[model samples]
Target: MKTARIIDILPQCYSLFLPPFFKNPIPIESAATCRNCAMLEKPDSHVHAPKFFSAKTKCCTHHPDIPNYLVGALMNSDDPEHETGRQRMLNRIAGKTSISPLGVFRPKKFTLLSRNSNLEYFGRSEFLRCPFHDDEGFCTVMPYWDAVCSTWFCKHDAGEEGWRFWRTLRTYLENLQKILSRYVLLKMDFKPSISGLSIDVSAPLTLQELDDLPPPEPIYRKSWGAWAGNETEFYKQAYTLIRQLSQDEFARIEGIEQKLLLRELEQAYGLLTTTPLPERLKKNPELNIEKISESSYLLSGYSPFDPLKISKRLYDCLDFFDGSLTNQQVIRLCHDQHEVGLPEEILKKLHRFRILIAVGETK
Candidate 1:
């Protein structure tokens, strides 16, 4: 039997050496692996950065699985020289061996209480050191941690900016993982869990064998009240953190996020406006429009997540259309008054549901 040797003392000394930006020091009693000194530190200007190793950091000891999306991203990194790093991550996930060259502190195998009520167990091999952690107790990769790893911060619920910033990005990271999960599920025939793939850990299963297993049944979704509720909220925190950090790396993330939002909005607009006016024009008979609040109206038609706020605009474009005007005419009317493309966004949204349809098709 193995024991979890969580290093408590080193973190106190480690916290002292961290840069000034890390204002919140996790209390020793509460800090987990994510808040451990190794996860918190970055390489200093004076000290040589240590090489990557498999030694167990304080986090691996307690957690169940390292997210596959994080593993996949690292493997598929733009850095072509990351082949060795990729193989190491694969080996760690596969439970191939216990001993590593770095003398990583290995932790006892632990079970995760999965949302699906399945006994999801990580292989005994994984609770060793994180591949990104170096000998000097610093994380080599900081910004790109997947949803679970990013929120490993012990002070997340403490209402601090740094912790909240990571929470804001969690959904975005999870969405990326969902895309990868779809690809793997279709191609590899493996089932996905809320945390990761559901796999048996009694014996190490080869990638090929794991692929042969049947899919797991879906489970109920867990919800939370987060500061960043959607894309709009996500960008709010992203900008706030960028200003606070003043780090150039965060600027790149912000740029990418901006492009993604623009692309999604553009896609939504194009999808609605491209249809011919005479082909399908009618309010969706099935659309259940419910006035949720004085300011917000919930229309049951299309929601990428939930019922979209149709009344956020000054004028409800959907209410204006009565199948008498063409899509182009309605767009012209709204744009002529607003003089900005903002009205066009509203028009596109109205066209999204059968609120202002293309005419020939009956809803």
Candidate 2:
């Protein structure tokens, strides 16, 4: 396997914040296939197979919080590719729709509805569709997308291991974004009023709040304080301030929680890239299997969106993995009894996806 670097998995916008040491390309997620989406339904698939996302939506369902620096970057970019995203940001600022000095937010109504429905709206509801998702089914803010958008993949190449790493990375980046945005506000001598700026969703929304309503003028003004009218300029300046922060300065701003999260992210990344096979394995009892053909079966336990395909011969070999035998023993037993030789790579994949579990482990 090729060695992966920190720069490979991170968003390009991080180049402004991260030190110069991080510079290398990592493996791209070929499995997710964004341009020609892999999540679309196939005509000949079995009825029991997982349904695909709509072509129009295709997992662009959740709204993301674009930090002040990113908002500024998008607004100030000169690249023609960024024009559509820039205009979208400008429109949001002009209309004062979910706009704050700190960042753009997911609207309260959508947030409430998503929460109320327990995120059943995810990948299914157009009502929760992202503002930056365009008619062409592309994200206008691609390179400058937020942590959540950047880190999430509908299907992972390393399966559950990949999912875990990205999820942890997303949390770490989110915390960093929050810290940096607030730091910029303080450095600009603007004291942010958290109560005034943050949406209060502890109580259910009123009927009026179910619309795309901006915050009341007085509260919005209170949140901005000194930078009330010059929101765009403030974001631009925020971008400049954040861009100039040295690695040491950045570290100084990070608290213990952030530090810990960074450590966890690194560990998760390592595990994702170098997933070790267990000594002994057993089949995951929860896997839902459907025979796709006389020779093949579809295994759907790793993820609801992506299923693993296995041959009927290999499916029969699963019974040998009762956790009592070592990996080599199981392989030898299968080869001797059924004349079926299991590949090391395929066994690793099965373990990664939890289709096969370690002897003492529970998922």
Candidate 3:
């Protein structure tokens, strides 16, 4: 049996390596592959999923199975000519992001990873088509992993940000792995675990040994507690770390985080505003981009109101409306003066509204 290796130590050292601005991370493989992760909205009640999985889930577990080709590219560092990500990354850096040290060291789902760090068991949703993925469906960078990312995969959480988010995850894991490796050697006096494990901090680390560590909790898939309970708290720490960095270091990490946040926010925010599928459909729906495309808008946690409120109000209002109501009329119904309420303009944009003007002219 092959031994397990974990970058339990690396996150500490390389926390500064990550950019600030706090983009969510994507999984390495299928979201379901992660025995530790969960699918929100109760994708399924299968015992392996996070607490949110419900039997009513209709999301089919078909996250385009990634063949060895894409995996091979990710596993190796053979940067291909078509690797548009390099440019994309640079462009994002030039855009809204600054190079700042992000507070990325917060731990997630310690219990799950601690119990099972099996790399082979990632979810299919975790597998993805990277934005940089070519028509051939292969990553441009086929080599040179920082190590941790080469081995991580997702639990196929429906909430997972697409592969674009994985870039930072890849970097974070790589750096984390390095930190864990060094710490393990120091702790073990420079020796591998008895099973010749690639890495093993399984020696039962104490909070003391892991001191100076941020108190982080696990979030299912790429989803997190966007409320003051978790999201704000988590972002606070992340920004705090970035703020401490010198301009150059902050810029470096911030640039990467900006790209990550934008792509992830695309999905999260979209879900926030769009009409959540019928309750039955949400319980058992096709999760392909095609199916998801029908949704009108992406509402993000960034909205002033509770993300679910907009969705709930939309659903409740839909129930009150006759299907015959014009789209504009429906939008008007959703409009509210309360700051927490959805505005017609913003709602229209969020739902990707299609306005049709009646054309009657003297011909």
Candidate 4:
């Protein structure tokens, strides 16, 4: 037999001993923003937190909810930690907890899933405030928020890092759902393939269906204590597994982040001419633009896109906008006054970075 080289042996062993993937390099921002937002001053204004909705910041357009399996997990009280989570969730459901009136859960209006039912119970209410929101503008049960609420992000807040983080989290949640659902079915001696986890509570499977086609005695214990133990163990394993899964997924996608961000920049560049330039566009009064170099300029309070590089023509074009001129007018003036073919591409980038805003209609 021919002697094998080390290079040939390395590939096979790499898969066998792959390290547990940990640490999300992406920094996720979790602070609520409704209290200090300028938009909240408008009577019709709605809070935007990208995706996650809690007591402090709420997305009125898309009211989010807890998933069934996670609810089941919360019902467990096997350990002190689990019991605390369970009681907090119950308090929210009962409207006993102090919560804000920003999302969709209202005190006295929120209803819980029947304890005797299978994994079909969920909350529903007519109000825009979440039930767990307190009078002080905070979520009473933020620590135990549902998976969706925990992972949502606003596009502005997320940028490329946030997007990648959410994608990985979404994958983790899907896998977790499968694992927990199967665990529930297996405890009752049912085949895992026969049941599917419902994302919608309005159309949940009846307790009879959860018992399977023949309707047998419940395989999973129904008592709060018994359910608590099962769910607590499941949550522990789910969290550990998701961390590894998210890491693995991130490793695979890490190489493409820069490329994707560049593509987004490119697309934004293309929209410059088509989208009407904000008629009232002007430099943020609080921010002063300073020249860093012949080609680079810096603006205070600007993030993600700051200290931008600019050509003399582009700088002149920005000066022309002045809240009095439209983008087209600026382009025309640059050519007439300076004989420069000012590129609209640079303006588009500035607009996207909040360097420009439509404060009012231009005269």
- Every model's TM-score: 0.28, 0.92, 0.23, 0.37
- Which is the better candidate, 2 or 3, if ranked by TM-score? 2
Best by TM-score: 2
Which sequence of candidate numbers ranks them by TM-score, best first? 2, 4, 1, 3
Please tell me which predicted candidate would have the highest lDDT against the true structure: 2
What overall lDDT, based on C-alpha atoms, would model 3 receive against the true structure?
Answer: 0.31
Candidate 1: list runs displaced more than 4 Å. 1-70, 78-84, 93-108, 112-132, 140-145, 154-165, 187-363
Those runs of model 2 whose alpha carbons end farther than 4 Å from true positions after fitting are 1-4, 8-13, 16-26, 44-47, 118-120, 194-197, 206-208
Model 2 poorest 10 in a row by lDDT: 19-28
Between the candidate structures 1 and 3, which one is better when assessed by TM-score?
A: 1
| TM-score (C-alpha) between model 1 and the true structure | 0.28
Error of 3 at 120 (Å): 23
Q: Enumerate clash totals for all models, in the order shown.
A: 14, 0, 64, 17
Q: Per-residue lDDT of 44-95 in model 2, one digit per residue for the tens? A: 6566666677777879988888888888878778889878888888888877
Q: Write the per-residue lDDT of candidate 3 for residues 161-265, one digit (tens) a residue.
A: 222233444454444333333333233242232211222344664453254232233312112222223322332343233224453653444345445544554
Of candidate 3, the 10-residue stretch with the lowest lDDT total is 280-289
lDDT-best of 1 and 2: 2
